[model samples]
Target: MGDNVVVSNMELERLLSMKGGKGEASYANNSQAQAIHAKSMLHLLKEALDGVELHAPNIPFVVVDLGCSCGTNTINVVDVMVEHIIKRYEALGCNPPEFSAFFTDLPSNDFNTLFQLLPPMANYGNSMEECLAANNHRCYFAAGVPGSFYRRLFPARSVDIFHSAFSLHWLSQVPESVEDKRSDAYNKGRVFTHGASEITTNAYKKQFQRDLAGFLNSRSIEMKSKGTMFLVCLGRTSVDPTDQGGAGLLFGTHFQDAWDDLVQEGLISNEKRDDFNIPVYAPSLQDFKEVVEADGSFSINKLEVFKGGSPLVVNQPDDASEVGRALANSCRSVAGVLVDAHIGDKLSEELFLRVEKRAANQGKELLEKLQFFHIVASLSFVL
Candidate 1:
């Protein structure tokens, strides 16, 4: 802005949320990438848990899952983390400490559906006791905590290990300048800063920096000294900002192209298109490290970045129609709600279908343009 002034847009989609509930529609498209990370996450969990030491011995071993949507992926993560922590206690000839896990997300998340998926063993309070009585080695307790992770959610040094995945790329809200008609950064016919001018991109960049700094500051407060955190999420594979390949998924140009067609059809107003910017930032690995090192609250234990390949690319469909359908469903699953709010459901559906056709036609071309960065960072809090 005129003075590096950054404004907030509360109308954001409240995190890169998946569909609510236990149904496949919630995030079936994400299953492949998530499964790939899950296997790797277990090894990270082993390292983090084995090396962890309770600051005050015998206190409840606390864990928090940031952005745990619907408990599908979270249940597995929580179960594995709890089991490993217990194994550490057993190795030391100590009785299993009371374990508590909190799954946090935005207040609007469908926690009811998430709870429905939990077995009686994960019910709060005496549930872990019952599991313990039955000789379940991983006696653990679970609950939901709903809020924006950009702010403080727990007391100082209250958490032992914090975990988040596929969620951190979501900015707390859309950048305000993108919606500011008076600002040169106004993206007159786009929905993100991806292909916009330098001003527009700068706006998104500032917003990301502000939100991430806040997130790290809050976590440093909640995490105890020597506590470890495991984070896995999407990022940029290179310093090149204009990697608008079809594979960019959330950050690609095709998304705006699909929306532009609707504007031509007079279904969506130019003003609305300019006003709606997706609250996401595909940051480079250096971007992440810079923020962490500046905060000085955590030491980087390990960091790795992988190229995220689309299932659409890997599994070539028989025809464009089939490809269109698959890509459309995938887009709808992640972004349907936001589209519905801005342009109404009817238009959003039509728009995504058109996007599908576009993706189908783009074919291997879009696949080649796929540019996504998957980051796994293991951090240790330095009190």
Candidate 2:
């Protein structure tokens, strides 16, 4: 990925820091909601563990939450899993088996935030020191592993359960065609229909296929036979090429419009636009399944979809006007890069206001254009 498009580790930390202001708060809020979806995956893991225990009663169990940002969600999942395991063991009239966990994410993610959260979490029942000393029936350890999930980040057959939430949909990098050329297709005030086509849609699907294969292949090597993986990601259901032009389309139509507006206002120069494209991609359900099943690495155990609602309506009271404002603000952040690229630093304020005004005019009912999907899928395979 190009340095400009890739959010460096330090930048990610800064964005998550309390000092980063409302942006950080927005990110945290969104992440927390996304984390709730992780609970759906946990349900599948419990089923897989049940199946495995029927064969290997004494085998150790390890769960890795890939892309475990700041470890808040990881800690939550661990607490629930531990409780469930204890109940199961009690029914069996035996002690709980040993368990370990690994929290993995980009090196730039806030591991310090996770560490700080852990001491408090460990002290919630018994102090962390006490838990470690009393480790007999079950042992829990959490550590940050810094690396991209697209590459092998764990040893082969080292993990029993693997889970990732709202993270894998991001492409390794922006599409080369978009990155290599400065096309008018990226201009602002352009309608979504102007450039919507099956060709572009197919290209995105192929890119997702490649990334998903890489992700699953690495996991296949690291997961033991009969191991399970629960992946929940942002996805779309519509196959109409035009519907693909929604604001949710990453680094494509909506983003291009932002850049175009900035350039027209003389805020950013075309030279900078040459190097700009967001390094995120959202895939359709069919494309997602193709990548997961193609490698023969996993068997689909369950699949379900839920509305992502509006990125803007989060945590707000159910007021139509306020919801509209929230959605507009969220859209602006995504479109801001494009606007900044064209308008330069000078007119950014003006461009932002204009974008906000445009969203308000469009209103909440129209904000359904920003709706996305939360896809939950479970897979199991023999290594």
Candidate 3:
């Protein structure tokens, strides 16, 4: 996956690829849980905003969505945030500051789709008029800032509130040490570190620590004193989620096994299979605590782990095949391009079909057995 990591058509950074287009092909349908979770996490934002001291009345109040894919969940997240802050201002009987919401993601992100969902006249994008109109806030702004969040994307102390959901599991880049030919942690069979040899798992851990250290350090420079960041993503509720059945971590394991089967049948090469690894990691609770404690950048105000339930869609069939197909579509919608980009699209269709078949075979029991655990945390920037 060395050459495969770089897509032939571009040099742009690609994270989890969101489904493209305006209709069924898009991610709008599959992200219902994200929207629900976005709404549910409002209290964290509110509690954090309660601590923000706006020294200058004319300065715009700022909120940024770190990985706002296609803006479906972004709208609700920003909407709820504005409502929360406005209520705080009202509670204090003070004039509210102007609002500015920044929606950021990788360069390859479908920002056009995200822009369509926003107010049209913003040119690049700056306002969600009708939503903010209801509140007493006079001016509301929204914009797409395309870049990797692991680096500096804004000025020092320029940010007030930061929010990210269902993102951050992605590593800035795949760990280079795992691919070493002479290394014991080569990850010869599977594409992830989740139940691999101790060397492999620890190699992945070191990458997360390095990447997360940079993430925290960069944010520390840009965040105002006590400015809070709320992050939620799939993570291990235990020290290791490898033993956790029905956890989202298994999807890669299942897919990698299928890839191996395909390799065995001479459909795909084992070298390509071994070379390709999913560039994501679900940090354990202790992993998160260790990073937060060592970084000296932020204090954890809250951290909670809970299982997320999949909402049944309207007009969707209640059978195993359809259920599995939808799940596959959702998977494809999110990570298909990333997979194809890493290995080329020649085998992608058949690969995901195999995934769909396996999922469908599980039937309604899949629904019963499906368990997605999320870690939501509130962090206050250390001054």
Candidate 4:
């Protein structure tokens, strides 16, 4: 919602990542909100696991967590999946098989931190004696997979269950047309397609369609027949990407003001801000259904849109600025890397500080508007 600025090209993959490590500002600490989303979907996940047909006994039951940013949230989801899977086998009167959990993310992801948080595998080692001694709780071996989910990451029929949370909204890259100066869809001053023009929004939607298709097709090849996939990601309550009430899908006005401040001070050019577009999209339920049906690899078991309120807002902070700062930190955990890559670390830090300050000044009313909508889907490969 600012003046049109010139454009430039920048690679997306090298910059896309969550803030790593266990530091106060890292994704591990800021991801409680994401953890909440995972918790809300547990019932559906358990129901899906109940129907999982156990493979030959004694073979490892493979589970993959796609887009597993460095955090306990990732570990928590894997634990629930593995534990439920084992329970499913037990309910079927079959001995639970060993488990393999693969945590996958971009190469830029901080795998070191993720591994450090993993429970000791000595208790869950391949040996049956160790597994029994540990009371069969720690029966899964963990591995880090550094790559994009849009590309194939596993061998055919290898994975038994796939779980991804708060991840798939990220497109493999921003659409080139939106950044092209000569194109009609050039996004101009906006960093995301929240209330952008119909043309600009359509460009992003097309990119999302391609990205989602690639993701599903890759999993179809890697996952075994009849395997299950559970996904949770940001989505829109409205079909129109131009809708401002699209669950406050991305950063709010405060973030834009921060960038404007930089531009006014001549710290960064307006063109630079224009060039930066976050490679994320929140599609409506209809958008998701169309893509899956067209792909024809998996049948959708359940797909629904649900609202989630942040703990920052839900707990009711007495100081509005406290909630503002908390919300900004959560955003920085995901967007800081990209901002730093585009405008250097010093400026990026200053920008986020400005955002926090502005958001705080705006107070409770503004922060409350930043609601989230989640699309939870359960799908299985066609037999």
Candidate 5:
């Protein structure tokens, strides 16, 4: 296969989901950084459910979590949504409707693990009977829908509410121009937006805009009129897409340094490092607004930027090696699969080990450098 063959738009849908299972390196264990953002945004989620027109008692009240990698954070979000929504209906003296929660990601996601983690559902499916029998106290039925969010997952006007966190920044694939070796826009040495050339950066920006628009368009079609979407994802504070403090901190130099170590040792060729680029782009606040406003389907109710600790480490304890290993595990959880796809398992393991050592030796300096921001927004469909 050619260097850029893996860059196909559909191919990444299979390749880029967070690593699966319940291991220490699984996304399930390494997702606290994501949980922090989702928890902070629960108010917005409640705000969204507040606006939704509750389904009739006979109809299921549908909620969908887009890009819901197999993790507890996914369940926590749905639990909060179900709880707050039930409260809203009760306050209005209405019979709470059956709830159907759909957890969606790529087909390769660990749905089995996610289903096992749910709070003792009677049985997992869309059946209202299962919802009633699974656990009398739990009112919702949970089912995993495996697909990309850039396209429609549910039927037209079927979903009443949607939630996604730390997911939208991922483009459907590496931008084609960036992967084409002959193109000036090729991301030659760099794997991500930070420190990229203007041409390479523009490719990433355009891809994000297209993907976000597709996401909104799909949701608009699938959502009931006035249905709500609450989204939270990695974002950049700087106007410049290539700013080091934003996505660059999360996806840029540290991995490159590890790749450099492999190259120096002749374990992998420099071209192997140069050929791969992470298919994620942290949009600026302006970039997000422009796409949503242009799409003109979902009326933006709330949009704002919030900063967070490095997505890798939450508290940043005094121990450098500890933080370093945390950072490495975090990367392994999200991108280790992609790296493994590119180079192979053994080399990918070696590469992340180097990342741990490098971050440990660099210590507090590395932690400070990786601080990044998040974008949270709530939108309601408008006919």
Candidate 6:
């Protein structure tokens, strides 16, 4: 286990409370596509499980969905997993073994939103009930165990399969070197660039390596031999050390742009920039492979990228003109801590307005240029 970074529960609660309802709305609105992604993950997990069964036939299975945000999407994943389990059991003509399902995320995730969405087994119709009756394997849901993936959060040899989607790219902490250095070279009047000094970039990468190793080591302890883990996350395609379009470039530059804009407009003080780093880290494929292979716990079974297009714009009515307001709102929750702590309430709004105006003037076409790689990788380890 590692010492988890301490974030005040009260502060996190305030941030979540501010965006809880809106985040729930976003999840509800995006349920369909999210379901599709979850099902795809299930398909990949099942394939891995099939290979595992060739060696260990009688062991029960435990599947965990990490960073399962509040909504039907979580249930959709459970549904798909249960359905697959039933199909597999029937084909084998063997009684299904006990199973445990875990849902995990940041302590600040909208768990209340999740609780409200739990499925009523009685209402799940006949087929699911028959499967449940035959198997006698109960479903369990839990939350708020671990924050950083850098630490062990479960018992050793306990998990059989782990699944996380749209998560795990979050860095444990901000790099110390970039803590307070604000320059137009990095941040320009609310329009930020991801250009970090070489030192800062290296520092961030080292932090990522440390966190990645810890994540895999912890998972190795809990995962049964030959257990499977599937992770789907946002990553960058470019591997170029000099390219500003890399994963580091995207975050550092964008943050700088936003910070600079805010500073020029007197929305934020330069001193606050040190406290304003986004908590997320988008790793490129090469970096991801380097970290995982170094851990020596699991081997890759499959890796692929999806959603090569720009940042997904939700709730925008116009197709050609992106909804800058909606985009800002969507970004606010994930990166809300930055605005609340640094720019404060009044200036954050002013800064967003300026950015939105610029986005509109640019015809929001540039927004369409922003691409994200949805990398899906499956891994399995020998017990």
Descending-lDDT candidate ranking: 5, 4, 1, 3, 2, 6
lDDT of 4: 0.79
Per-residue lDDT, model 6, residue 372, is 57
For model 1 the local lDDT of residue 219 reads: 97
Clashes of 2: 13
**lDDT of model 1 at residue 358?**
83
- lDDT per residue, candidate 6, 1-383, as tens digits? 11122233235423432234434224444344445555555666677656554223355566787767666666666556645665677677665554557777666666776766675433233444464664423343333343545577788988777777766766666544445345322321222224545455555567667877888888999888777877887666655422334333334443356666765666456545544555455666777788788888788888766554444445453543455554444455455544554455566566555545544554455455555566678898765
- What is the lDDT for 213 in model 1? 88
lDDT of 1 by residue, 280-368 (tens): 77677777888899999988888877655653433554566666666666666666656666666577777887787887886655555
Residues 1-383, candidate 2: write the lDDT tens digits. Answer: 12134333234322321111235223333344445545545666576555443123356667888877654566776666655655576577675555667888766566776766664323325533354456332246566788888889988887877878777765665455443345433322332222445544455456667888999999999988787777877666666533543334433433455556766766555655544444444566777777777889888887766665545544434455554445445544433433343344346455445555545555645455665576677788665
Can you give the lDDT of residue 379 in candidate 1? 90
Model 5: what TM-score? 0.92
Query: How do the residues 186-303 of candidate 4 rate in per-residue lDDT, one tens digit apiece?
Result: 9888787776789998988899899999999999999887999988888878767766343343464677778888889888887888888777888889889999999999888899
Clash-forming residue pairs, model 3: 126-141, 126-142
> For model 1, what is the C-alpha lDDT against the true structure?
0.71
**Model 2 lDDT on a 0 to 1 scale:** 0.57
Better of 4 and 6 by TM-score: 4
Model 2 scores worst on lDDT over the 10 consecutive residues at 13-22
What TM-score, to 2 decimals, does candidate 6 have?
A: 0.78
lDDT (CA) per prediction: 0.71, 0.57, 0.70, 0.79, 0.82, 0.57
lDDT of 1 at 218: 97
